[model samples]
Target: MGEIKNRLRKDLTAAMKQRDDFAKSTIRMALAAIQYAEVAGDQARNLSEAEEIAIITKEQRSRTESAQTYADAGRPELAEKEAAEADFLTRYLPQPLSQDELVAIVDAQMAATEAELGAKPTMRQMGAVVKAVNEKVAGRADGKTVAGLVKARINS
Candidate 1:
């Protein structure tokens, strides 16, 4: 099993022993999602750490969006629950990049791309830059944030 998968299992056991209903359920849901991903194709296989992280990130994003929707619909209780679940899941994710860090990464990637292509990337090359940045940052930053930064850097 992957390092992350082992940690999740351990944490789930702890949560269950401590009678943490929320944590237990949230961890269960995350494990289920990981299992689904493992069996998603023509064959069943264990997930790598990167794959596990991707699954957790997807779950966290879903919870965040659901919480926002619930809040906007005036369902504070449900929203709070979803937010709590998201916060719990975040424990398994890498810390998010700060605005400054993200900008620095974008600047570095842009410079490298410029050097490679012999010109600064145009808005037309935004996708390539964004892809490179996403690879560099992995799941530490949101795609929309990275895209926005890439767009601004390209235009400027």
Candidate 2:
């Protein structure tokens, strides 16, 4: 938004004036990503709130992955830096879905499928069950985790 961008610009300037390198760099990175989206034409027009949220989500995910890799390489200082940036980015993202919500979605999908199947179905049912639950919980949970949970639910 024009207002948010203006505020970010002011904050970035203040951070630079204060020699707050981390804050300045993180805000610059986020701004660059927003500009890149515009350049790529995906956001040719003014960005919607949802589009901004998606961009922030992407930045947060990248920061999280980078932090994990840094930690795994025994660079705790760098990892902590990445994590702090992630925390900043997270402020712009939607609240993450909880495990309970995810599980309930998965269960609902299974119940609906079982009702259709009338009883026990073949192993092939796994794919359909997973597909259905995944649609219901799309973008909220990790795909691999959902698949594993669906498999375990199907087996039990």
Query: Which lDDT values do the candidates have, in the order given?
Result: 0.93, 0.78
What does candidate 2's lDDT look like per residue over 1-156, in tens digits?
644455568889999999999889999998888777766854466666556656767788899999999999999999999999999876555566788888888888888888898976446898888777766654456667788878888788
In terms of TM-score, the best-performing candidate is 1
What is the C-alpha RMSD, rounded to one decimal, of candidate 2? Answer: 4.1
TM-score to native of every candidate shown: 0.96, 0.66
Residue 47 in candidate 2, Cα distance off native in Å: 5.5
- Model 2 TM: 0.66
User: How many pairs in model 1 have backbone atoms within 3 A of each other, for residues 3 or more apart or on separate chains, i.e. clashes?
Assistant: 0
Quality of model 1 by C-alpha lDDT:
0.93
Model 2, position 109: C-alpha lDDT score: 81
Instruction: Estimate the overall C-alpha local distance difference test score of candidate 2.
Output: 0.78
* lDDT (10s digit) by residue, model 1, range 83-122: 9999989999988899999999999999998999999889
